[model samples]
Target: MEFAGCSRGSSGRALALAICLLALISLSCAARLSASSRQKLDVHKHLNRLNKPAVKSIKSPDGDIIDCVHISQQPAFDHPYLKDHKIQMRPTYHPEGLFAENKVAESTKERVNTQLWHVNGRCPEDTIPVRRTKEDDILRASSMKHYGRKKQRTIPKSADPDLANESGHQHAIAYVNGDKYYGAKATINVWEPKIQQPNEFSLSQLWVLGGSFGEDLNSIEAGWQVSPDLYGDNNTRLFTYWTSDAYQATGCYNLLCSGFIQINNEIAMGASISPVSGVRGSQYDISILVWKDPKEGHWWMQFGNDYVLGYWPSYLFSYLADSASMVEWGGEVVNSEPDGQHTSTQMGSGRFPEEGFGKASYFRNIQVVDSSNNLKAPKGLGTFTEQPNCYDVRTGSNGDWGHYFYYGGPGKNSNCP
Candidate 1:
């Protein structure tokens, strides 16, 4: 679900002065607290509204669910962290498989499948609406003694902050790093699964990160998610999030923040995606690329074969101002077991990778941008699963796919539950 950023070192005296300066400067900008101190902030005050029944759920004319809670877009001038940041729409640069001939002004939803959310993915005038599920994610986690399955597990301050362990109930993932990475690319399959709760979601994504996870992690993420609170449907949708400091206040869903500039009119970050092969097929896949524009100092995201969406301005990040130190890809699912049983919702497809190629879901053509700005296959690909019976990953090499892997499994099974 998220990458725990790598750490950095600086001179003790210099670091002290920098922290003081950063605090003074960030008080008027985005002042980030150390990870330990950050969690102590009064998060309850910010999330209390989540329980209000006033926040109603409604349906769009197209029948898509809308958890009508619109998080007001913070004014650019008001964001202490990312103030007056650059946000814009650029000309479309078709990615690899996207054909200009098949290009449509609107998404395939208008022609091939049902249109959900905003027809063109446009939110209200200045308000950026996100899946109500995001709110649920925050509230649900906060309501618990332990953080929700995903968020609590990510922070080292939590009881089981270790991402490498096998206790399962993962908000878990695998990564490659120890160097300054520029970007990461992966082609991930999209699947819609049966969700058990309004707050539960199943996702598989790529995380390109700079800085360490504790206090100074900056990240750019993209992938497919079946999150009802956010999208209000069982249809898996393409989604993205960017943060200058961490996932807390600086970043949000797709264009929810005034940070990620959207250029492609054809694809919307959280809009429902109608995979060409449908949820049950092995053919549906989308290649995602996130790279830094060395010349412009901006981070860009490219989708599929053609749609080169907008970017996150460099000023919005610290480590990402130049390059990332780590890259991660894999699946994450919420184990919202009310009665202490595993959730039935699935990750990728509800099937095991042991089911074989066509029957199982996968990520292929995985690559990363080297410091030289080359799209090269990743080195040292590794896999991690919290529960072997609940989920698993198998890696392989082939000329066509490069560093690729097949991963997925039902959340509920005799051994898992």
Candidate 2:
């Protein structure tokens, strides 16, 4: 009888242990679900982010991990211009959505390629790009709210902790034509840079301006950069920025501002353009041309051949409203290296331009829009650098590339720092 009682006691203890194990497992699962529910990625309260069909998330050039969402209407700022046009959520020929209808048949034939966007300063579609302020997806960028603690400040935005909210673009640019600028064009290669700080990045791009480089500067900037400090991953992407008064209160990187508008979603400023880019020696570099319409007085930005993203309106700038005074093209790097050793942060490919073609990085066929709105090879080109040992430029003109140059060097070179 005693033996029988002991067996019953043992069984009771075993049952209690199992129940405890089950409870612990349930608690763990619930904790995971709760944490996931609290940590939502899309911080922009746009309605399109809710309960949408499962879409792939891509890394933005600046480093934010964003889920792709669709919009059928223009942002509130572009409402006036988009009133007459139907919104296009996907590219006509590209395939990424259930709504994407391929309109063109793929060609397998060999073909000759020519320049895109004849210097007429006309947008492919009749519509132009616009920007937004106060409330926009890109405004809440760095909504991961800055990864950790405070580190450094480049321009004293002591209160705004979000990297994007700060002076987002701290560039090391090369300039030409200080007062004779109309428009500028260049082809830039994209590369993923090593990012040490959330606010720092590396890229190759073009900056066209009209006013002085001081607080009154009016400019248009476009390029490709890898900013993990901003986006999340080091995915290189196309980017654009414009401001009537420097970068103070009027403009933003990509569509974060209220003046630039988008008609095609196939290739966007912040979206990953990786599938068709990044491979060297494959005729895959991005050709960007920003020219002003002498008649309409609008600045138009064009990408490659088929994609004309859109334009920034004339009334958007005080200085650029008339004409650009200067033009610039080259590589930029923001180094927030904490250990103080040069941030392995590369500007172009992290390789020296002396390495050449597939081995290094370069910009070819650099041109500018003349008064007649034609793409003309640059004349009397001159270059500038903040630090020659870390980054440099070499320009030349030829029958093939017209006027082009090779630039960029790894930060913290053996001879630099």
Candidate 3:
């Protein structure tokens, strides 16, 4: 009888342990489900904030949805400072010595570039086109807050080569310093350079800089870029970026944030540009001009000769509220150096500057806006490259093209390794 009682006791203990284990498993699965629910809710809330109610929507061939949001209801007004801000319809003054773009030679006129979305439809006169953000776009980011924002320390620090190298960003640039600048202009050659990794990107841009190259740097950038991680494709797109505090918390790409106000209803930021340049083929390019309005103190951006896109409010910056200390123009590529070797991503045309002309990428007719609101050629222009063997730059000038440079190269050459 005593032996039988012991067996019963042992069975009782075993049953209790089994019950306890089952309870723990249930709790864990419930917790996981709750966490996943919270993430979905957060993503939806963010999408609601960014994608305002659209009066009309157009679907582009490239799988983009363009929402025509009312001007007053645009994202810029979401900022506390812009809550009561009055939109400036036009700049108080345009810089003199504008390029005669209409007089381009007939041979080069075949290189016209346009946004891919134009083939579908146009936004209404009183609305601005915004590229609608999708759930996958948010999920692709490391986090919701970092979506549509650049990683920190991406700028090329010309004064500190060591710091530039540590940042993993390579550049072939022409820069001007030692004087206050109001703005900058460049005609950038556009090409869809092959990106080896989704996280890496290639771009040709002009940087208008203020303050030192440290934590307090201010910058306004506009250019053409091919970033698969950012846009989920290899198509070259027109993009703009600004930062009042060196890209920490103050800015975002295009209109993903609430700082830059878009006044024009035609061109949509973040849309793909068609007719990219090909090697030894007809070359295509885009002209970007970013200048500060002397009277209003706001920074204005003009794309090509027709579209005066919009402006960054004077309140959005500190040092740039007055003038820029430096201007840089050229190509930059993110070199992640996968597998302990240089990446195979291409910058610009992915050909050395020595190739020249249609075979290489070039920035021509570079200019800077002076304090007197005049556009003039930069003085004492200097070039910089982190790894000359992997990428390089060469500058030249003439009566027709003014000041220009051919720059870029394949990243993972034998010498680069």
Candidate 4:
């Protein structure tokens, strides 16, 4: 009878323990569900903030939704300082000595680049096109708050070789410093470079930099890129980035943040550009010009020859408010190979600068705006690359192309590894 009693006690205790375990599991699941629910709510709230009301919506072939938001209601006005900002419809001063289009026409066999969204519909005059941010777009980010932001310390510093290697970013760039630059212009050769991983990207751009390359640096960037992580696709897209504090919290890519004011109803900031350059085929490039207004001190960007895209108000920057101290133009790629192997991602045309012409990507007509607001060939152009075996840059000048450089390469080869 005592043995029977002991057995009963043991069974009862076991059953109670089982019940306790089940209860804890249920509570844990409930907590997870609650947290997930809150996260969904926050994501929706962010989407609501970013995807402004549209006067019209056009679906592009590339699966992008372009929303025609009223110019006054753009995300730019969200900044507290810009609450009373009057939009500068046009730049007060235009840089002189723009490279003649006839020169490009006579030299290379090129095609015109257009945004995919233009095939469907057009936004009205008083509205600007904005790429609609979907829930999946935000969810693809490491976190909701970090969506559309470059990782910290992504920009290359010529002085800090160690920092560039640590950041996993490699560049083949042509830079000019030691002068007060008001603007920069480059006709960047665009390609849909293959990204080895979703987290990696390849781009060709121009950088207007100010201050030291430290935490307090200010930069304005414009170019074309293929970022699978940011856009959730492998399409080449037009992008712009700015950071008043070295990419920590100051800015975001394209129209993802509350800064650059867009006055043009055309050219969606994050939309895909079609007809990327092909191997040994017709080449395509886009001319990007970023300059500061001498009068208002606002920085302006012009796409191609026309299409004055927008401006970053003078107050958005500290060092750039006066002028840029340096300018860099060329290709950069993120090498995120986990196995210590070089990434196979391609930068620019994925062909080394030695390939030349249609076989390699090139930045032609590279010019910087002088203190007098006139665009002229940059002097003392210097090139830098972390690993020349992986990628490289070679510069040249001619009457037809002005100051030009052929750059980029396939990221990983026997030598690079």
Predicted candidate 4 versus true structure: per-residue lDDT over 189-273, tens digit per residue: 8899999899899999999999987888999999999998889999999999999999989899998989999999989898899
Q: Per-residue lDDT for 141-248 in model 2, tens only?
A: 544332211122222111122442233323334455744656777766545556556567777788887766457777788877776544455666677877777555
- Candidate 3 residue lDDT tens string, 1-417: 233223457676677666667878999999999999999999999999999999999999999999999999999999999999999989998999765544653446677688998899999998999999999888889899899998888877886787887657899999999999999998889999999989899989999999887889999999999988888889999999999888887899999999999999989999999989999888998989999999999999999887999999989889998999999999899888877899989989999999999889999889999989999999999999999999999999997788999999999998888
Question: Candidate 2: how large is its RMSD?
Answer: 11.8
Between prediction 1 and prediction 3, which has the larger TM-score? 3
- In model 1, which runs have C-alpha deviations exceeding 4 angstroms? 1-61, 64-174, 276-282
TM-score of each: 0.67, 0.65, 0.95, 0.96
- Report lDDT (Cα) of residue 306, candidate 2: 61
Per-model lDDT: 0.61, 0.56, 0.90, 0.90
Off by more than 4 A, model 4? 1-8, 99-101, 105-110
Comparison by TM-score, 1 against 2, better one = 1
lDDT, candidate 3, equals 0.90
